[model samples]
Target: MKSSESTNTGLVVGKFWPPHRGHQLLLETAAAQVAELVVLVYANPAGPGPAADRLPAATRAQWIRELYRGDELAQGPRIGTTPLRVFALSAEGDGVPPDAAPDDVHREFVRQWLARQGIAVATVFSSEAYGPGFAQHLGAAHVSVDAARRHVPVSGTLVRKNPLATAAYLHPLVAAQLGVVPPAAIPRVVLLGAESSGKSTLCAALAEACHTAWVPEYGRTLHEQKNGNLAYEDLLYIARRHAELEDEAAHKARKVLFCDTNAATTALYSYYYFHRCDPALQAMAAVCGQRYAHTFVCAPTVPFEQDGWRGPEALRSFQHGMILMQLDFYRIPYVLVEGSVAERVAQVRRALGMVDDA
Candidate 1:
């Protein structure tokens, strides 16, 4: 806010609850015309949005970064050109009335906010009727992009109502955060198996081959960090955190997500160790049957590498059988993928309706 920005810099403000293609168009159109662009993200004026609908300001910044930079976004130092600057200010009831108010009132509110930041923006870009007045209040020129929505034909309200149905309008980042991963957009593919069944390896290979991304076993990371000293409550945390991780990874994966594990596996481990699992975890585990597009079990045919955390070498077969029994008990159908990592990857490709290179 208090830096050495030039006078030719531009400004764009919104409550980007979830960024859609329309929003992307506005930003891109504005960015191309300015030396630098400042995107100010604010909370809903009615009040803070529901937890599920909230998109953090920092995350919006990252979206813009990814939008403009692509694979070169985070690469070390750039040789030429300035980059976009993002700021999130959620000051509710700080004298700025709700967006439903007249343009004059909202304009003054934005002017004061920018004044506080020591920014004298040259041009204000928007896709709404208030763009001219809003810019005038800040003593800047106004550039309205597509005020009619003919170009993108999407809106925040339309997206918020039924995000999954409008998944195509949303950016990958927004869709993933809103849990709008429709099958045509992004499919959640879960891999299940007992310990040392090559589940993790298969997940990585499939992700790489499919040119997508995968979610690793969060519980395994915790186990290693805790040195295999997980307690009862940890199971519930693992189940919830694993689901969150899957949603987070969806933004990175466009085609399909090869998940290393799911809440069902967590509940099974909890019941195995404590003789019972949390009801909350059990409920979440039940959702796994319908949550995933495809379920593949990495067969324990290969040698069981004895990891320090695995309970015992003999428990592998028993645990493997138990997993199959649980799947049958719940009437959840799954494919039993066996053999080397490449062969398993090929099986997954076939399941995904992709050509198997192997």
Candidate 2:
């Protein structure tokens, strides 16, 4: 028989290492039977064990809120009226001893902790078999939801073991935190160099060779759209767009995302045209170097072709030196890609440890 559910307030407690669909189901089921539902998310800031794998506690609590708050819960008509209260319990140096098993000692500490918060739980919900004993300790009836994991067919253990494999079972927000790269794991390669240094050509060739997605230079788009009249303010916008495009391409990449130009190159241009880089552009440049798994610095072996929009062709080598210095300053590792397009592509492939199937 199902346990008593006629209660004013109910609670569902869990570590929520990475909140999954199973947790969502348990919460929705509990909220359906109670007027108010208090979700006590147990977060271990110190990272309890290998099971946790250093997933942030605050992020997990936020995931619970994201899953249960307002319209998110409205889909379930029963959960709509139930006022959900989300709270965090730091499992590190908290109520119960760390070594204590999930028994009366742990349940009693949680019961007392809830009591101290002026919340008198009349029903307790959980997926574990020990829910009844835990509820009894708090003088509340236990409402077991998916005790056999038949409903959701997913668990924290499965998720922790391989988040990317079980990405479908996790909320978008939680999955993002666990490094579950949507689509697949793809190495991002940014081709950073001076103007007319074959960066665009090399990026396209690499993308084609690797059979991956590529992000074209956003600055070129902006320059074309604005008729080449670029202001200092536009530099930051270019940097921001570069990052956005990289993120977008990463989702579609097969094994690598090739970027024609990155934020560092944008910052260099800012200084080249405006005599200085904006603080915002500098910040973008600072972070841009790390965004790519690998960067290829194009050597100015090919003659600089002034495309009407470019600066003095004479400054190509100087600009190449500046790009190299910037990479050094950021401590970003990069390979100098010179010679022909085929040679540059081969160099990048060797660095990435890709066997030439061709």
Candidate 3:
């Protein structure tokens, strides 16, 4: 291994299992010393990682580009205007055998591949101990960056064990892929009832009282957009949009997420207005039941307003009864929210154990 001053062109190769900040620093260090830098990503096909956990080679290459692209969100130091190139070595083209050991076998394959590309490697940058032999074999100087792992202390293994704990060492996109919810998991509280049952008002009040985020009724948003000219096909879309918004809000929720409605409401409306509900809406409704930890069924006791959007007041009781039946069919636990806005909030907070009954 030699110092960085003797290098004109640098090469780096690693599995980049998740491309944590340590990998970012190694690439940044190489770019600082060399006129040009090339990064190669290699993940053994026979590795122990689950197929779903293994990110595609192309995706890792894109991560390299994004990390060094000089954006504020990009991790590690800015590369300024350094010429950087990323490559994913194909198992067939690069002659990387599935059973070959990572020691000399992988090093020789890398040397041959670099030589084939007419890349005269002046320096090989790495944080691993194999850097010296790999660089010497390629007739290039080895520039070891952070051998003690001080600068950006992290590893791919450390990340996989507890992703949410070490999330600060990962790129946003990479962290998201690992299913790391940045915020703590929160209980999703859904409000359910017939239209004009004060479900929306209750949802907002609960969100404010709990000091957390809330998902508004997407069905209402779509209704206002279409001037209440909704169709049977719109039920599924509204159900899907409601779930998407709920998921987005979950990441930002404090301890709980207040939702105006769930897919059960969508399925109920579909059967009520169209005389029959679609099978897909039924499945989504079932899935929604499993998502919310708690639900509050608003009682239809208030005066029914003759809104331009709602149906006849005569159907109010029937709608309310249908919601109860659907809730029971789905086996979703819910408390009946009755009385004024303050009373309803108090009931929900008590049901969710957000406050003591005293």
Candidate 4:
């Protein structure tokens, strides 16, 4: 039966620790049967048991919202007209019954919680065999979807063991959060150096050689746009937009993405000019090291070019030193690239374990 007890809403509940397409199938199926659906995600914020492996409750809830209610899963185009309400029910410190508790006990626990929340439901949707019994306990109809997993052919264990291998069965948002790089996930190779250290030239050449995509320094473009007159606040905007540009290029990237510079380098310049750094920009710089698959520090060994907006050759050297210091402070590993653009390209290729022309 698709639905019953039209006066009451429908309910679907699960840990949704690492939700897969199977969960989506259940949700869509449930929504089809009711005027409204409420998904209650459960997880233990503090645990030493099976729930310890579960993603945080808030995180799981966010994943559900992102999949069904946000962006790509935006309203009106989905399977059902029923609005879905999603929230996390903390298993810890909430008097919720343990998973091992008897069915009667667990059902009572859910009943009390629902009563407290003032939520009434007539249908309990699930993929598990417990659906019918659970629903009967709540005086609701049981609408089971794919109990054999025939439609989805995937499980939480299978998805967790090898997320990358089973990405097709998982949403892009879930795969990303679980650290499973999407097929379209481009490896970002970030180059850090002083101005006129050949980062831009090398970035373009490497992208061409690899037949991929490259992101030019947005910071420099923004600097020029502001006529080289920047304030402390401008640094945050530059760092943010620079990252956004890189992300935009990543979608069209063939195998990898080459970035001329990163947010940390932006922070260096920010501190250099204004002696201050916005907290948000600082946070971006702090995690910037982890964002790149490879880091290349362009050496100032090549003669510095005299761009109209550039500082003296001495300033270039000082900035190079500062960049290196920042890398060491953050313990970010990087390969040093010097000489002509072609030579640097070859060096990068060698770092990637490809044959390079020395």
Candidate 5:
């Protein structure tokens, strides 16, 4: 809450449980009017279930800071306190309200917090029901920016209920929060296979051989989170996000990246699990075919070990067949990788025409 004496200062307030496109638009609009903008991410304990139910206030502030750190619009706005200071505001008295509305109480708390920090707010910016009135209470100009009609509206409730439905409307900040990055320049190579196929092992080897980056399978992480039994949609979402991370890593990498798996594998897995296909899965598979430069199919060479999350041998065998069918259907050329880790690494080098000396 350290104050800066900038001539034009604006304060934006929100729960920002998860900062989204709507938040970005409001901030963008406020920046146009102010030389400096102070974004206050508010946390209220009196209104909601548990404070933990919402995204942490610190995390929300981080999203705002990251979104504006190098962004064009953020260059002039002075969005936060520490140069790029996105502030975190919390209600006082355990956030319990005696009589006032929770929003009003939170606003009053914010004003007190700013005063304590020796900061003066000139304007309050927001896109919420309580924004204008709160601004007036603080002796600041009020600006309400509408998010419903401008761009795609993004809401935390919508995202929590249906991430895929709102994924398209998510801002870059939200994508980053969810570990998604935009496509990069490096070549993306995906490794496809069933569980216990050593795809992850081979990916690490290939990355080492080429001195490049690799994206580990997020499915395993998701599987662990779900206590072993994952739904078809969960697998599909992880696969799609894995591909996205690969693209992002590729951009940051020197030459190329090794992806542990791709969307085609996910689509086939979904089909195998549900005996049907979803349009999102299909679209993801199609997109993967165009994005990957090469795909390495790890032939099922070993028996299914009792990995904490892996299925039985029968399921692995079935998944293996489905993978092959997907490759044929997509018409994507894939080199079959078999044998030890060393052998797989050599095959990858040969495929990419990169010799040890090179």
Candidate 6:
């Protein structure tokens, strides 16, 4: 069932909207058998909405290249550096069956594209039920790694459905590919507050005034994507991931990173809503306190908007107090940002010791 001994190039095809562990396992297994691997990322612009939800084809290709750019593939006489080839395939008018099943049409189109590139595809790797038949039709061998029977065969659907439960199944490499790396150096100045506290607006102005980079809040974007029904756990996950990403971005910047919020905010938010905090959330808060050089608490000023995903203004006010209390308990240095937008931005620039004209 597993090819542990073989030396031939292979082709693996998938939508890989957001490549997960199952996909990575199949790719690694196939790479073991193949002398080289060509990963064909298929995108049908005219297909249903599900295909559109995947990361853009260009972004997916970048993640794949970053994942395998310097990785060593094989060992021994059969040992050689495994080179990963990422290709973007468009099936607009390639003479392929238009009404065929999406997967089938995609596989056939990919085969034709590869042939035109002068590259012979010996095998196709996948674990889906339809993969074997599709591979056979293309005259390429089929390699399927039955991860379904494994303990952690988490699917993209399952993760999208309940991302919190499957966070443990995420591989570091995949996380990095997804732009979720912990920063090598921590930002000295961090923002901590509840939703609708004008944290993002203030952070942006501060970053501009100080000539530093700002890590935009990812939760709001996720909220908009989910139409405001995102669970509290998803918010927590996004908060944690945001901190990791902020650190990564700040590591390369010359000045402090003006982050919108940190994991502590998530811990408080989850506890407020669920009546308890997840242990992982508590640990993350502890790590955050030690990671940041300074922390700023944004006071809830403007009336909260009941965006599809947001609660009422009264609830936001309560959450703001809870967040401040949590910050106090953690002993993190803090300043409160308040007043009009201009005043808040001015205060932030002053706190960070940046010279401003007005």
Query: In order, what lDDT does every prediction score?
Result: 0.74, 0.74, 0.75, 0.76, 0.68, 0.65
- lDDT of model 4 at position 10: 85
Query: Candidates 1 and 4: which is better by TM-score?
Result: 1
Across residues 1-358, which tens digit of lDDT does each residue of candidate 6 receive? 3355756678887666556667777777777778788887655552234535445555565545544432112221111356677775555544434434576666666677778888887888887888788788778888778636384477766655554555545543344333332334535677766777888778777777776678877766666766656564464456555755675676566567777777777666667667776544565666666557678888888667665566767787788788777877977778998898799887877776765533
Span of 10 residues, lowest total lDDT, candidate 1 = 70-79
Clashing residue pairs for model 5: 80-85, 81-85
Estimate TM-scores for all models.
Answer: 0.56, 0.50, 0.50, 0.53, 0.52, 0.49
- The true-structure Cα RMSD of candidate 3 reads 10.6
Regions of model 6 farther than 4 Å from truth: 1-186, 232-236, 356-358
**Best by TM-score, which number?**
1
Better of 3 and 5 by TM-score: 5
Once superposed on the true structure, which residue ranges of model 5 sit more than 4 Å away at CA? 1-183
- Please list the residue runs of candidate 2 whose C-alpha ends up more than 4 Å from where it truly belongs after superposition: 1-185
Q: Which one wins on lDDT?
A: 4
What does candidate 2 score on TM? 0.50
Q: Ten consecutive residues with minimal summed lDDT in candidate 5?
A: 70-79
Q: After superposition, how far is residue 26 of candidate 2 from its true place, in Å?
A: 26
For residues 1-358, could you state the per-residue lDDT of candidate 3 as single tens digits? 2244544888998878778888878887888788788888876672336732346666667656655543222233236556787887656566665535757787778877887888888889999888999899989899899988888788877876777788768654455456542332577888888878999888888788888899999988888887877777677667755765776888898888998988778888888778887554665677555567788889999878877888888888888898888888878777998999999999888877879423
- Model 3: weakest 10-residue lDDT segment is 69-78
How do these models rank on TM-score, best leading?
A: 1, 4, 5, 2, 3, 6
